[model samples]
Target: MPRGRPAGVPPIGSYTAVGDSFTEGVGDPGPGGWIGWADRLAALLADRHAEHAPPGSFRYANLAVRGRLLDRIVAEQVPRAVELAPELVTFCAGGNDILRPSGDPDLLAERFEQAVAALRAVVPTVMVCTGFDTRGVPVLGLLRGKIATYNAHIRAVADRYDCPVLDLWSLRAMRDRRAWSEDRLHLSTEGHVRVALRAAQVLGLTPPADPDQPWPPQARPLRSQVRRDNIHWAREHLVPWIGRRLRGESSGDDVLPKRPELVPLELPGAVEA
Candidate 1:
């Protein structure tokens, strides 16, 4: 069954996905472009729930906006999410905070905590938070360090709020340069599928029927053009580890595992860059 819908709820269970471009599936084609992982996650959840849950027990709403910041989410998205009163709420945010010139890690964490707290007040069942993908950006050369700091903040917030988090930053895909788009920011189709699969495993839903299928036929040429160096990164480093966490097979570590080789590129004369 799909991930978010509660077992025994009506087939049309409601959900609200709040996040940035990654959640919006920015590069993906059409409205359903692989641009946002949230849509893919929603689809996976619905499809699986349809199959596994008794008839008519899955539905969701994607409220993710492109380029959204943590502050903006509190100002706009959270109120709507409260009104939706979804059975499940997934929060995928923080990339923009890391990208903005004036982004503050402390403020980002505070807002995230507030957002989760607000969401929980409305929907108590499931609240999923996502971390960043710190690979391939020239400006974000300190991506790994920044992500570690930010994820630490997120983990703290999750523990305080009693929510689940999906650590996309430490995933092997973020370490491998090939998993990123040519722009060196957004995810490629393969990256989207990997994220969806991971989310499925987390939500306890069946994996996509064909996990290897590319979203658009045109993406095939793009896929070929990019090197597939980190193709096994997700399977090797992320999947098994996160699978254990989701299944309650292991205790999750508060500190993110290190991948120094995957660290962001350093700029000359930059502090810890």
Candidate 2:
């Protein structure tokens, strides 16, 4: 783990994040990777600590790699993260696996399971698994089915581990074609902010105050894409969802109430839910 505040540096809860590109702020542009969800989540956690009058502050390290698969995360990121001994750890992966034409469902499941097991061995961490985005790919025809299978597998793995899972798959914004970047894989700046806010909510972090006015001067694509408003949706919705689960709110496969219909594709490992 990286060094924290001096012994006198005020004890803030520590957080560490690991996974692939989404975790890396692949398309976000800003200091502290603020464009990415992980950074936004960290900020929210820190703000929450501030509101509470304090036992400590919030510290975070993001070690996500671009294009990283679960196997690589297990072999590489986890070891380094364990050193941080974080109080909270969030992971966003499986997009690459689902995108691969030949990726195996069982293999993906096995790798995800191993990653979770390895993390658990290190710390009593709160693990978060983000769902995949199926709308933006050029090869959506080949990748759609696999994405759903991977998400279901992720849910299963979360259940097995008794960890909280944020159902990003059900976020209404993700299904909208206009909500993506030009690459069709990455989120637009606005999308990234939305994702960040949502993840914060999932983690039970307080949202930042809204801007005095509506954001984004205009609906331009590459230039005016990022919107900071309502970015806290996740904090409002997902955070409570996680808290309920932690408080023993309910069990028995708590899938989100409404989800987008799975787009059918002829891919291996694809299964109907």
Residue ranges of candidate 1 with Cα displaced over 4 Å: 1-12, 31-35, 52-57, 133-137, 209-273
Q: What is the lDDT of residue 82 in candidate 2?
A: 71
Winning candidate number (lDDT):
1
Q: Write the per-residue lDDT of candidate 1 for residues 45-149, one digit (tens) a residue.
A: 565556666544555566666656677767777777888787677787776677555767777888778888888997865455555554554446666677778
Distance from true location, Cα of 158 in model 1, Å: 0.9
- True-structure lDDT of candidate 1: 0.59
Instruction: Report how far off residue 91 is in candidate 1 (Å).
Output: 0.7
